[model samples]
Target chain A: MRTKRTNWLATCFLIAGSVFLLFPLYMTFMLSIKDNKEIADSVLAFPKVWRWENFITAAEKVNYWQKFKNSSIITVLTVTFTLFTNSFVAYAIKKKFDHKFFKGLYFYFISAMFVPFPIIMLPVVKLTARLGLDNLYGLILLYIVYGLSFNVLLYVGYLRSLPQELDEAAIVDGASVWQTFWKIIFPLLAPINATVAIITTVWAWNDFLLPLIMLDQESQTTLPLAQFIFQSKFGQDTNLAFASYLMAMAPLLIVYILAQKWIISGVTRGAVK
Target chain B: MKKNNFGIYLLLVLPATILFFIFHTIPAVMGIFYSFTDWNGLKPTYKMVGFINYLNVFKDKDVLDAYLFTFKFAILTTVIVNVVSLCIALALNSNIKLKNFFKGLYFMPYILSMLIVAYIFNYFFANFWIDIMGYLGIEKWMVNPLGNEKGAWLAIVFVTVWQSAAFNTVLYLAGLQTISEDLYEASALDGANKWKEFWGITFPMIAPFFTINMVLSLKGFLQVFDQVLALTGGGPFGVTRSIALLIYKNGFSGNEFAYQSANAVIYFVVIVAISLIQLRYLQKREMNL
Candidate 1:
C-alpha cells in the first residue's frame, strides 16, 4: 500500500514535469499557425483563423529548400566520413596497441577532447580561408576532424571488448589488413557505428556557430543560420518567425519520432560508455 | 616482414592523422603561437609581444566579469541539472506506466538545436510568461526575463537545465539499471526504508554517473554560447556574456585575435584542471564505496 502511494506520487510529478518540458514545443506549434492580431490579443488562445499560409510565406522568405539541401549534404557527408576515418584509425590503434607509436597516437588524438573549440576557432577560420575551404565542404571537413577525438574514444573502447582472434582468423584466410577490417571487423561494428553516426548527424545538422563564422556566402547558409538571419530580419512578424522555427524543427522531429528508440539507446550508450 | 607490417599500419592511419594534424594540431599550435604576438587577424604582419596579451586579460573588466558570470552559471546549472535529472531518473526507474514514452519525450529537447530551443523559450519568456503574469495581476513579473539583467542569466540556466537534464537523466537511468534487482530485494528484506535504501545502495551505485554528469555539465556550461547568444546575446549591459562568447567576439569582431587567444589558452587550462580535479575526487569516493 505504501509503495503504491509513493508510485502514484512519482507519476504525478513526472506528469507535471512532462507538461513543463513540452510547453514550449506546444506553443511553437500553436503560434506557428497564429496571425498577428490573434497573437496580440491572446498569446495562449486558440487561433480564430489559423494562418496555414504562414508556413508557405515563411518558407519562401527563408529559401527553405536551398538551406535544407545545404544542411543535408553537410550532415550526410560528415557522418559518412567521420565513421570511416575515426573507425579506421581506431582499428589500427587497437591492433597495434602494444606498439609505442600507436599507443602515443591514441593519446594524441583523444587529448584534443580536453581542448575547447574556441582555442582553435580563430586559427581554423584563418586556415580555412587560406586553404580555400571557407564553405560547406570546409565545414564538413571540420566536423569530421573535430569529431575524431570523441568518435575515436568510442570506437577504441568498443574495439577493446572484441577479441583479437577475429583479426587473426581473417589474416589466416589470406586477407590483407584492410580487407580483414572491411570484410570481417567492420561488419561487427554495427552498434558503435550507429552511435557515432547518430552523434555526428545531430551535431552537424544542428550546429550554428561553425557555419556562422566559416561560411561567408549567403547561399551557404544551413537551416539554423538561415533561421537566425530570417529572425533578425522578420522577427517582428511573430507568426512568420514561429513558422520558420517550426519548419526548422520539423525534419528532425519527424526523424526522432520515427527512430526515437534507436536514437535514445545510441545516445545513452555514447554517454555512459 | 616486421617493417612491412609497420608500413601497412601507418598507411591505414595516415588519412585521419593528416587531417587531424592540419585541422586540430596546426590550429592549436598556431593559437598558442599567436598569443605571444600582436596579430589582429587581418594584418599580414605581426610582432612578438610577450605576456602583454595575457596581462591585459587580467586587467580587462569585461573578461573578469565574463569569468565571474560563467563560473556562476556553470556551477548553478551543474548542481540543478544533476539534482533534477537524478530525481527524474529515479522516478523513471520505479515501476511506471508508459516508461518508454516518457523516456523518449524527456530526451526530445536534447536532440533539438540549442539555438532553436533557446529561441522557443525566448518567445515564451517574452510573450507567454508576461501574458500569464498579467492575467494573474502580477505586474512586476510581466517584464521579459531576457531583457532584465538579473533575470537573464537565470533564464539561461532554466533553459539549459530544461534541455540538459534529459541527457543527464538518460545517463542516470543507465546507471540506475546497473544496480541489481537482487540487491534491492536483499535490502528490502533487511527492513531498510526507502531513504536508507537510496543512500546506502542507489546513491553509491550511481556515483560514477553523478561524476560523469557533473564534470560534463560543468565543462559544457563553462563554455555556454548558443543559449546565451539566442536568449540574451550577452546583453542588458553585457552581464550574461560567457567566456566562449567573449573570446569569439574579441577575436573576430573586436580584432583582439592574439589577446583572445591568450584568454582561450587560460580557459583551456582552467577546464582541464577542473575536469581532472572532479575525476580524481569522484573516483576516490567511488573507491571508498
Candidate 2:
C-alpha cells in the first residue's frame, strides 16, 4: 500500500515534468494563432480569433520558396562535404595502430574539437574575405572544415567497431583497396552516413552565423538570414512576426517529427558508442 | 598491397585535411595571433599592438560582465541539463507503457533546429503560457520569462533545460540500458533500497556516458547563440549577451576584428580549461569497464 502510494506520487511527478517540458512549445502554437492586441492583453488567454491569414501573409512576405531553396542548397552541400571528409579522415585514422602519422593525424583532428568557434569567428571572416571564399561556395567550405571533427569521431568509432572479416573477404576475392572501400566498406557505412547527414542537416539548416558573415549580399542570404530579415521587417507586427516564425518552422518541425526516431537512435548510439 | 593501402589512406584524408587546415586550424591560429594586432579585418595595413587588445578586453566592463554571465550560464545550463537529463532518464527507464512515444516527444526539441526551437519559445515565453497560467488561476506573477534580467536568465535556462534534457535523457537511457540488469538484481538481493541502488549501481555504470554527456553539453552550451539572438537579443540593456553573441557583435557588427578575436581567444581558453578539468575528473572516476 505504501509502495503503491509512492509509485503514484512518482507517476504524477513524471507526468507533471513532461507537461512542463511541453508547455513552452504548446504556448508557442497558441501565441502564433492570436492577434497582437490579444497577445499583450490576454498573455495566456485563448485566441479570440484564429487569424489563419497570418501564415499566408508570412509565407508571401518571406518569399518562402527562395529561402527554402537557399537552405536546401546549403544543407545539401554541407552534408555532402562533411560526410565525405569525416569518413575519409576516419578511414585514415582507423588505419593508425602501426602508422605514427595516422596517429598524429587522429590527434590533430580530435584536438580541433577543443577550440571554440567564437575565438576564430572574427579572424576567419577576415581570412574568408582575403581568400575570396566569402560567398556561397566559401560558406560551404568553411562549414565542412570546422564541422569535421565531431562527425569524424562518429565515423571513426563506427568504423573501429567494424569487423575485419569483410575486408579480408574482399581482399581474398581480389578486390582493390579503393574497390574494397567503395564497393564494400562504403555500402556498410549507410546507417552512420545517414546519421551524419541528419545531424549535419539540422546544424546546417539552422546555421545563422557563418552565412551571416560570408553571404552579405542580399541575393545570397539563406533561410535563416531571410528569416532574420522577415523578423526585423515585421518586428512591430508581432502577429505577423509570429506568423513568419511559424511558417519558417513548419517544414523543419514536420521533418523532425517524422525523423525523430531514426535521429534519436543515431544520436544515442553515436554518443554512447 | 600494403604500400597501396598506405597510398589509399593518404588519398582519402587529403581533401578533408586541406579544408580543415584552411578553415579551422589556420583561422584558429590566426584568431589567437591577430588578437594582438590592430587589424580592422579589412584594410591592408596593420600593426602588432601587444597587450593593448587584452587590456581593452579587460577594461571593457561589458565584456567582463559577458564573461561572468556566459560562465555562469554555461555552468548552470550544463549542471541543469545533466540533472534534468538524469531525472527524465530515470523516469523513462522505468516500466512505462508509452515510453518510446514520450521519449520521442521529449526529444523533439533537440532535433528541431535551434532556430525553430527559439522561435517556439520566443512565442511561448511572451504570450501563451501566461494565458494558460491565467486559465489555471495562478496568473499573478505574469512575468515574461524572456523579458527582464532574472526572467531572461530563467527563460533561457528553462528553454535550454527543456530542449536539451531530452537529448541527455536519451544518452542516460542508453547508459541505463548498458548497466547490467544483473547489477540491479544484485542490489535488490542485497536489500539495497532504490536510491541506494541508483547511487551505487546505476550511477557508476554510466561513467563514460556521464563524461561524454557532460562534455557535449558543455561544448554545446558554451557556444550558445541562437536563443539569445531570437529570444532576448541581449535586451533590457544588454544583460543576455552570451560570450558567443558578444564575439559575433564585436566581430561582425562592432568592426573590431582583432579585438573580437581576443575575446574569442579568451572564451576558448576558458572553455578548454573547464573541459579539461571535467574530462580529467570524469576519467579519474571512471572504472575500467
Candidate 3:
C-alpha cells in the first residue's frame, strides 16, 4: 500500500516536471506557427493557420546561410585551437612536475581562470583593433584567450588520470617530447580530446556577449547577432521572429542531436570527476 | 631527430600559444593597468588618473546590489536544484517504469540556450500556463512571477532549477548506483526504517557527489547572463540584474569602460572569495563515506 502511494506520487511529480520542461518548447512551436494577431489574442490556442513559410521568410531576411558559414568557422576553429593549446599546456605542466617551473606555470594558469572577462574584454577589444585583427581572425584570437585556461584545467585533470610511464617509454625509444605527444600520447588521449572539443565548441557557438561586443560591425556579426537583430526588429510578428530563432538554432540543434550521447556521458562524467 | 622533434613540438603548440598570449594574457595584464587608470573605456585621448575608478566602485550601491543578487541566486538555485534533483533521482532509483524516457524528457531543457529558455519562459508567463490554468478553472494562481521584484527573482530561481535539475538527477543517480546493496541489507537488519536508512547510509555515500553538484550549480548560477538579459533585460527597475549582466552592460553597453573594469574586478573578487568560503565550510561539514 505504501509502495502504491509512492508510485502515484512519483507519477504526479514526473508529469508536473515534464510539463514544466516541455511547456516553453511547445509554446515556442505554437508561437512560430501563430501570427501576431493570434499570439496577441492567445498563445495557448491551436493555430488556425500554420505559418509554414515563417522559417523560410526568417532565413531570407537574416541571411541564414551566411551566418551559418560564419558560425561554422568560428566553432570549428575555436574548438581546434582551444583543445590543442589546452592539451599541450596540460602536457607541459605534467612534464614539468619534476622541474622548477611547474609551480609557477600551474599557479599562473589557475589564477587566470578567476580573472573575469569584463576586466579584460575592453582592453582586448582595443588591442584587437590595434593589431588589425578586428575581424574573424580577431574574434578567433579572443576566443582562444578566454577559452584556453579552462581547456588547460580539463586537460590537466585528464592528464593526471593517465600514467606517466607512457612518457618514460617514449623517451627511452628515441621519441622526443613532441614525437611522444603527437604520435603516442595524443592518440591515447582521444576520449579526453573529444570531451574538450565538444565542451569548447558549445561554449564558442553559444557565446553572445563576446560577439555582440566585438563583432559590432555588421559584416563581422555571427549568427546570434543576426538572429537577435531579426527577432528584435520584427518581434511583434511572431512568425518571422520565431522562424529566425529556429533557423539560428538549427545547425547547433542538429549537431547536438548527433552527439547527444557522447555529450551527455561526457558532461555527466565531468561532473562526477 | 632531436632538433627536428623539438621544433615540431613547439610548432604543435604555436598557433594556440600565440592566440592566447595576444588575446587573453595580454588583456588580463592590461585590465589591471586600466583599472588603476581613469581612461573612459573608449577615448584614445585621456589622462591616466590613478586609483580613482577603483575608489568610485567601492562607493557604488548598484555594484553591491549586483553582488548580493548574484549570491542570492547562486544559493537559492543550488539548494532548490539539488533537492529537486535528489527527489527525482530517488524516484528513478526506485522501480520506476519509463525511466530512460523520463530522464531524456527531463534533460531536453539542458541543451537549449539560456536566451531561448528565457524567451520560452516569458511566453509561458504571458500565455501558456495561464491558459492551462483557465482551462482548469484555477485562474487565481496564474499570476506572472517573472514581473515583480522579489517574485521575479524567485521565478528565475525556479526556472533555473527546473532547467538544470535533470542533469543533477543524473549525477545523483550515478552516485546512488555506486552504493552497495549490502548497505541496505545491513540497515534492514538493524531495525531501521527507510527514512533512517536513507539519512544514515544513502546520504553519506553521496556526499562527494553533493559537493560536486554544489560547485557546478554555483558556477552556473553566478554567471547567469543570457536568461536575465533576454527575459527581463534586468528590468522592472534593475531588480533582476546580476553582477555579470551589470559588468557587461556597464563595460560594453554603457561604455563606462574604466568604471566597469573596476566593477568587474570587484565582482571577480567576490565570486572567488565566496566560493572559497563555501568550499571551506563544505569541507568541514561533509560526512565521511
Candidate 4:
C-alpha cells in the first residue's frame, strides 16, 4: 500500500519534470508557427493563423539545403573516419597491450584527453592555414584526430571483455593479421561501433567553433553556423528566426523521436564508460 | 610471421598516431611556445617577450572578468547539474511506470545542438518570459536577463543546467542500476526510511560516477562557448565572457594571437590542476566509501 502511494507520487513528479524539460521545445514549435505580431500577445497560445510559410521563407533565405549538405558531409565523414581509425588504433594496441611501445602510446593518447580544445585551437588554425586544409575535409580530419582517444578507449574496453581464444582460433586457421581483424575481431565490435558512431555523429553535427574557424567560405557553412548568420541577419523577425531554428533542429529532433532507444542507450553506454 | 605481425601493428596504428600528433600534439606544443611571443596572426616578423603576455593577462580587466565569470559559472552549474540529475535519477529509478518515456523526454534536449537550444531559450528570455511575467505581475522576469551583466551569467548557468541534467541523470541511472536491490531491502528491513536508505545505500554506491560527472561537467562548463555565443555574445560590456570566448575574440578578432595563446596556456594549466585535484579528492572518497 505504501509502495503504491509512493510510486504514484513519483509518477506525478516525473510528469512535472518532463513538462518543464519539454517547455522550451514546445515554445519553439509554437513560436515557429505564429507570426511575429502574435508572439508578443500569446506566449503559450495556439496561433489563430499559423504562419507555416515562415519555414519556407527561412529555408529559402538561409539556403538551407546547401548548409544541410555541408553538415551531412562533415558529420558522415567524421563518423566514418573516426570509427575506422580509432578501431584500428585500439585493435593494434589491444593486440600488443603489453608491448612497451604500445603501452606508452596508449598512455599518451589517454593523457591527451585532459588537454582541452582551447589549449590547442589557436595553433591548429594556423597549422590548417599553412597546410591548405581550412575546409570541410580538413574539418573532418580534425574531428577524427580529436575523437581518437575517447573512441579508442571505448574500443579497448570492449576488446578486453571478449575472449582472447576467439582471435587465437582465427590465427591458428592461418589467418593473416589483417584477415583476422577484418573477419573475426571487427565483426565482434559491432555494438561498440554503433555507440561510437552515434555519439560522434551527434557531436560533429552540433559542433560550431571548429567549423567557424576552419571553414572560411560561405558555401561551406554548416547548419549551425548558417543558422547563426541567418538569425543575425533576421534578428528582428522572431517568427522567421524561430522557423530557422526549427529547421536547424528538425533533423536531429526527428532522429531522436524515431530512434530514442538507440540514442539513449548509446549515450548511456558512452557516458558510463 | 613475427616481422609480419610487427608490420601489421605499424600499419594499423600509424595513421591515427600521425594524425593525432600533427593536429593535437603539435598544436599543444605550439600553443605553449607561442605564449611567450608577440606573434600576431598577420605579422610576418615577431619577437619573444618573456612573460609579458602572462603579466598582461593579470593586468587586463576584461580577461580577469572572463576568468572570474567562467570559474563562478562552472562551479554553480556543476553543483546544480549534479543535484538535479541525481534527484531525477533517484525518482526514475523508483517503481514508476513510463519511466522510459520520462527519461527520453528529459534527454531530448541534450541531443539537439546547444546553439539551437540556446537560441530557443533566447526567445523566451528576450520576449516570451517578459510578457508572461508582466501579465502575472512578476516584475523581475520582465527584464531580459541576457541584456543585464549580472543576470546574463545566471541565465547562461540556468540554460546549461537544464540541458546537462539529463545527461548526468543517465549517468547516475547507470550507476543506480549497478547497485543491487538487496542492500536497499536490507536497509528497509532494519527500519531505514527513504532518506536514510538513499544516504546509506545510494549515494556511496555511486561515488565513482559522482566523481566522473563532477570532473566532466566542471571541465565542460569551464570551456563554455556555444551557449554564450548563441545567447549573449558577451554582451552588456562583456561581463559574461568565458575563457574560450575570450580566447577566440582576442586571438582571431583582436589579432592578439600570441597574447591569447598565453591566456590559453594559463587557462589550460588551471584546468589541468583543478582536474587533478578533483580526481584525487573524489577518487580518495570513492576508496574510502
- TM-scores for all candidates? 0.97, 0.91, 0.89, 0.96
Better of 3 and 4 by lDDT: 4
Q: For residues B1-289, what per-residue lDDT tens digits would candidate 1 score against the true structure?
A: 1223677999889888988899999998999999999999898899999999999999999999999999999999999999999999999888777788888888888779899999999988987778778999999878898999888899999999998898899899989988888888888888999999999999999989888888888988988998999999998899999999998898999989999999999998999999999989989988898
Q: What TM-score did chain B of candidate 4 earn?
A: 0.95
Model 1 clash pairs? Answer: none
lDDT of 3 by residue, B108-222 (tens): 5566566756666766765555666778998565666676666677777867776678778878987888888888877788888979988898999888888867876786688
List, for all models, the DockQ compared with the true complex: 0.60, 0.50, 0.41, 0.64
lDDT of 3 by residue, A157-180 (tens): 787888878777777878778778
Two-chain DockQ for model 4: 0.64
Task: Give the clashing pairs for model 4.
Answer: none
**Model 3 in CAPRI terms: which quality?**
acceptable
Q: Show the lowest summed lDDT stretch of 10 residues, model 3 chain B.
A: B1-10
Cα deviation of B20, candidate 4, in Å: 0.4
- RMSD (CA, Å), candidate 4 to true, equals 1.8
Tens-place lDDT per residue, model 2, B1-289, is: 4333777677778877887887888888998898899988777889999979988998998898887777778889999999988888887777665666777876776655565567667866665657657778886556676767776866787777877787788888889888776667767778888888877888888877889999879888888887788888877678888888888887776778888888888888888898899888889878543
Q: Supply the TM-score of chain A against the true chain A for every candidate structure.
A: 0.96, 0.88, 0.91, 0.95
Expressed as tens digits, the lDDT of each residue in A1-273 for candidate 1 is 224334776777889999998889888888889888888787677888888999999999999999999999999999998888789899999888889999999999888888888999989999999999999999999999889888889999998888868888767777899898899999999999999998888889999889988999999999999988987898888888989999988898899999999998887777666
lDDT string for model 2 (A183-221, tens) is 878888888888888778877887887787778677777
| lDDT for each residue of candidate 4 in B83-162, tens digit (9 for 90 to 100) | 99998888888888887788788778777888888888887788666777789999976788999876899999998988
Show how many residue pairs clash in every candidate, following the order shown.
0, 3, 0, 0
TM-score of model 1 (CA atoms): 0.97
Compare the candidates by DockQ and give the number of the best one: 4
- lDDT ranking, best first: 1, 4, 2, 3
